[model samples]
Target: MTHLRAGLVQQPAWPDKQKSLAASAEGIRALAADGARLVLLQELHATHYFCQTEDADLFDLAEPLDGPTTTCLAALAAELDIVIVGSIFERRAAGVYHNTAVVLDGKKGRVGHYRKMHIPDDPGFYEKFYFTPGDAAQQEGLGFTPVETSVGRLGILVCWDQWYPEAARLMALAGADILLYPTAIGWDPDEEGDENQRQLDAWTLIQRSHAVANGLPVMVANRTGHEAAPDQSSAGIRFWGGSFIAGPQGEFLEHAGEEPTTLITDISMARSEQIRRMWPYLRDRRVDAYGHLTRRYID
Candidate 1:
């Protein structure tokens, strides 16, 4: 483990898959030019917030594991000698799809994939309709699994998955060296005061806590800008941008705000090792008594 340069692509996405792909490719290319060795794209980088509506035709967007999108990204990774982590919609079969993050290593290796486990079903976020609940490896089925890349073992979890401490801990226990999340979260464009601040604070605090609890570096790349639905007149979700990188102690290294940009940060794997040694939370575990965590409530 040593110091390395990593990147986050935080651009506002589009409804057209081709345009979104091109937009993000530009960011990745610029980051590579900046000498980034690992690039993390925001969740579902090649589409808008389609999870908002669950039309059946949206299924067309889902691709096979080794689809055209992966082909392009693979070529990009090999050309730049940089690892690329992209969130994709994987069409498993006729009607099954998973919210997956596929890792393309520098050598063009299809490193691995992790489906999003904690799917959220909120007002603006209706993921349950499109995503098959991840059969995370920590459990029993083929859910979210952290991916390994040339930089390190990446604990890739999606947006809603970041809220759960258990999610991050399980990945760490399973040998993940870094915690990564590709997100799409924001406020309603009409939010005026304290309520908006609270939401943003909670979002940042929770993710930073993941790093604090696990003693690992955390990267959260989010979408920027606002996209309006065709017929809806309500305040659309204003993706607050603010893509960030946090150290083991939950210190912010770099963060981008409500704008289209790519952020490059220095990831010190050595620093994380040192923090883990001092904290030693992983060493002082009560794994034997943690079975109750599996249940919703312990009576």
Candidate 2:
């Protein structure tokens, strides 16, 4: 019976890179102390939600894949002998950038990275301006590019990617044992009461649906806090951090609050196989008839 104890690190992020990274390290250490074999960090954990305002200055925050942050995480994961999943701001090149997830395998070094494919260009999130879409097809986007860590294959995805069923399906099909999402999303300050609740509900429902559809466990670690728009300073985003884990059949396992938190939960690897055998949805899929999925509309 292979089992894993996973930790979700949900914490507030400031506008300072140094402080935020240090805080994440400290939080990770604390979770490791609690006997977590793997820990997941929130999206863009290094700094505030800079996408609030599109500015050329923010590009300085981007760094090479082998730069300071990834370097430190490599050493940390190795030292702790635990798997670490981190979302980072990557400067792929001068003009090329991406919102990517870095999987630091303590046993194997820097294994790989996943570039965010679904870049949301909404009011608060201006990711499209900053990120070059992975450009890879859905098959390449979320097909369980595991880090081959100390424990097992770590299937990690970014925030916006969670909404697309194709992404999650590809991960499960690629033999991912667990699904991890490092996220940053919340209610708009201008939105009213019920609207905020509705948004949060939809976010939770969509991710859980992915878990249920794929018959695999899912974990989400989100940031919490209201970061002022750097330019306006008057209004900003209130990150409603409701991090959680869902089991096969979309069962709610454990949920974190709308605040800074670190939680660990045990998962049974066999359950994935057991559930899949019973449901058999993946086996019954009509892949040959899925061409219509590519179309924007039936018309």
Candidate 3:
């Protein structure tokens, strides 16, 4: 009968940081009213997806770990008596930045953060221009360890990290009860047919597989709406906001649409225990045989 109520806030980010923060706070309060103990916001919830283009000015968007964004979220968490997972453009130091997720504890204030490990450099996702890869050597110091909370130990990752099963496996092995991904991913408006559907399917399938493999619930919060390119050289990205939650057995617990929505669902820790006992993927892992994983290429 051990259960935890989780909430996912999937919404479009406004150009104005203050306005987006207000809207996000309102959404979090609403979820709290609905009995959610742990609420997660979409990646970079306070501002637009500045990574759409590689303007040097966008670097100004990054803030320190104890900056205004985290301060506001921590206060909100304390006020609402809930745990919040919020993503931010982190200004680690001068000329050093990272895509980070900050965990706010209702009673303890700002608890920890997880910097994004995998930085993507695709056509639309010019993340490499803006962010530095997280330092793996300081995993525990940088908040890679699951944040201990009243509901459960939360294993949080950012957008690009969702594709890598290795990251999920490491978190699960370290005693994470649930995996949470705060993502901001979308499709090119020009290619909105079979390709779009295929991409979305692949994204959904991969995350669900993580849940099944780790024997833990997985929750994803994605942004929605069309964000135009700053220079308007091409059609903007139409964020495919299909935020969802799946159980330990990869059963769909709740799903959202391509619009501003709030998804709330109850996760059963006992069910996770049952699934892990039955599946035993972790027990069967051949750790000693994974040395090749560290190599760039075997050939």
Candidate 4:
């Protein structure tokens, strides 16, 4: 496709799975009705940000690959004849879980998936305690591989993975047509106003840089509203919903605020090629000297 009409659903999630799923479905339907051939939803749209507190019983929230989240999204894709990208807390096996992104194609149904590689462990965000980092080397098609769908090859990455340029570069090298991030990020309510602004600005800048460097359009969908910590350990997170779509040159095609929004924008699929020809960052990469990147530190 030379041009693709994409939709991004940025909304708040609730603790109830059914409620959250219903909201996501509504946004998907609205976007599809707006003539969007592709729709993207925020991370863990089915439930609240449960990583705020890790409890053994919380494991019940994890579902199989063919669980309700994927099943529902697949059905929607079939119904609307539009490709949909959704996130899931995957229950891979006993005591093994991953933060995964699932792609549903209009014609092919469920096409591919990507497991979040970078797991963050912070005060308000304690993901390392819950998710097992994705091991790309252990499996054949598990790592930074793009999910091939009818619309295009989607390089789907979860929240923290968005920060790593290496992750984005690998996906681009593997032939990703576009980069998509389903994120659930927010600011600590206790943080100062200026600090929070800086955090949000940095987050936006890094993602746009990926688009500029890889010469691919970027789509980001983030949840909105404030989610209180289960254990009241902190003041909770006020999710800064700045979901956006950026062009190959890192130009903002569409942007949202800190509220529920459905971003609809038409991206020129051919622009990436034109931009790459102009910049040609990939053609000049020094791949041979980067072998030491595999090491943790030079010292």
Pick out the ten consecutive residues of candidate 4 with the lowest summed lDDT: 133-142
- In every candidate, how many clashes are there? 4, 0, 0, 0
Residue-level lDDT tens digits of model 2 in 1-299: 38888888888889788899898999899989888888899999998999987898889989888788888788889999888888789998889998888888786767777888788998878888888876564343333454456667667778999899888887787777888889999877877788899989999999999889999999999999888888894478888899998887888888987988888888887788899999999999999999999899998
Candidate 3 TM-score to native: 0.97
State the TM-score for model 4: 0.98
lDDT of each prediction vs. the true structure? 0.86, 0.84, 0.90, 0.92
Model 4 lDDT tens row, 1-299: 89999999999999899999999999999999999999999999999999998788888999998899999999999999999999999999999999988888885788888888999998878898889988786243389988878888888888999999999999999899999999999988778778888999999999999999999999999999999999888888999999999999899999999999899999999999999999999999999989998999999
Where does the lowest 10-residue lDDT sum fall in candidate 2? Answer: 137-146
Candidate order (TM-score) = 4, 3, 1, 2
How big is the positional error of residue 146 in model 2, measured in Å on the Cα after superposition?
3.8
User: lDDT by residue for model 1 over 32-52, one digit each (tens)?
Assistant: 999899899999988898877
- For model 4 the local lDDT of residue 47 reads 96
Candidate 2: Cα lDDT at 148: 56
RMSD of each: 1.8, 1.9, 1.2, 1.1
